[model samples]
Target: MQYSDKYLAFMGRAPKKIPHWEHWSNPDAETYLTGIDYYEHPRLCRLKLSQLYPQLELPIPEKDDPKPRPKLDLKGQSSNVDEHGGHHVRWGDTETTQWDWGKHFKDAEDVFAFSPLAQGDFTDIPVVESRDYSDEEKLYQEYRKMYPKEWGDKAPKGSTASVSFYNTMFMWPLLTFGWELFLETCLDPRFERIMTEFAEINRRVFRVFSRLPVNFVICHDDIVTSRGPTCSPKWMHKYIFPCYEEFWSIVKAAGKEVIFMSDGNMDAYVNDIMACGARGIISEPYTDYKKIARRYKDCFLAGEGDNRILYRSNPDEIRAMVESMVETSRITGGYMMCIGNHIPWNIPPKAVKYYLDISAELAHR
Candidate 1:
């Protein structure tokens, strides 16, 4: 829960300018508590490498012990299946990714037969016809049963990942069907009905979600792509936005900080996302960070530490990128640094270190 308050405070009530760089430099700074990564890249695992570099405020692994716990069948019947019978496998044995949809659309009809969603041809929902069953219907049923980290009496006494709550409530619906299907459905004329069923499925999950003691909840729904939206903006307004509203309303009602995270050129949705009640907007580099940080002063703006610059930039360019990003984050107040997308394996390890060094320097300033 470290810096959770500062993160919440800034988002809950961010001021126009963070005049004092001193507070940010505070070793106890709330910003230090924030760590976000989704990658197979070795550089992302700071804790594992931290002992070699003690000076950096690198990410600490949640586990105090390296000894493995009893391996639960995280992937179930089909090698770690979730409630929807989706296979959940890690990518290249890294701590970062869980390969699912990008691998195959879980629970999709056999006709899909493991083909990518783009391959299918459907006039209606690309997924099987929608279904809304009783509350007894579990979404991440196997996931919960297999690995219940810090749940109930088992809650840890201290530091864990920056995200205290591991939740996929919003994303579960998206994954239950999948991105391709969801996008196709949203574009289809029957968008409302299809999305409604999706919403109903989420309702059942959230009903269970309400019981959890989590203050920070991340709603991962990457509805955008490099070009723009995978779904049309108009479709987003009518069908998708309502789903978001319904999904986030529960978090808002529970007095939680909604960290709505998205991946691509999602600048268009910043205001709408904030309007939908997200206290924090976790985004990637393609998003307009400067505009969001400057304009949405009251919201926590995260992840503008573009790795693309690090991947290709010379030392000077990397420094400038870090300085500008750090400065903007400082001016905006509630900002958490993150690399663009994943820290791809090709990225120079030195570059990552340099980025962190600059961030640490900025943090200490």
Candidate 2:
């Protein structure tokens, strides 16, 4: 089958090709496609597609029917926003309050001194505060009022939205606290309580946001190392799985899909992750996609391209990577391809363009 037909069928849409590429780079449109504005750089998309399909034209269709807008069922989820303004931290800077817990520990001796034992009591740590329901409810009401313009005329139609709680534990804790202290906390009961408290906060947030119109929630919490998971699967099942299950159950009860995004090699805990109620996983290319696709054919799969190749490799290499990823992920069903992570700032803009362009072409082939 043609790529467009396959994608439409996969999405449960009629097998007619849609003019999706023309609006691929629009933030509003792309968010509908990938669940985030992570890659709304139109120039990048344009350049990438031009390189991948040099002979193919990407003209905006003339006299075409106005395409229906995408709608999602965010019944028990919330939008993760940086209401504080500014992009969330991206490396560097030592004293930012939002530094990952690990990073905080690395920089602040005081935090290390205050580090709690893995099994230590956290009953006194104060239950994490919840968002004001009135405020959130008002926001939702306003959002619903504006949903028509924001989402056009489409209603929930088998579309999904990716919603993550926050950055991964690996990235967030290490950055918020010093690595040593963060590690200590991971092992200590007191630290576990703090983590649990934060998880509660996430739960409350999820409750508020899920009331919106979305269908899938992608919770991100990386626990893997380059070689394998940093902690034992048992440890994750003990400390993290409960939180995931709680939130995932909420999402699933509201009839939305749940997925997780992690980094590094996670070959050992795929079963555990699946048991946590997630339908798919996203990560950098450290894990084996072939194994994952074969093992979890019922779940969705996203990510797995090498960022270094997009930044430094030639066009041929980029094309090869795209083809391999698309083929590998196109296993039984439920796959979407993207950069292993955010595109590096140093990668030539043209290289980024070439990568995305090829992906679009392949998706429509």
Task: Highest TM-score: give the candidate number.
Answer: 1
List, in order, the clash count of every candidate structure. 4, 52
Please state every model's RMSD to the true fold in angstroms. 10.7, 11.7
- Root-mean-square deviation of candidate 2: 11.7
lDDT of 2 at 51: 52
lDDT of 2: 0.54
Which candidate gets the maximum lDDT versus the true structure?
2
Candidate lDDT (C-alpha), each: 0.51, 0.54
Q: Please report the TM-score between candidate 2 and the true structure.
A: 0.61
Report the C-alpha lDDT of model 2 over 160-260, residue by residue, as the tens digit: 43344544233434444545666666666555555654555455556754665666565776687768877776677777777777777876787767777
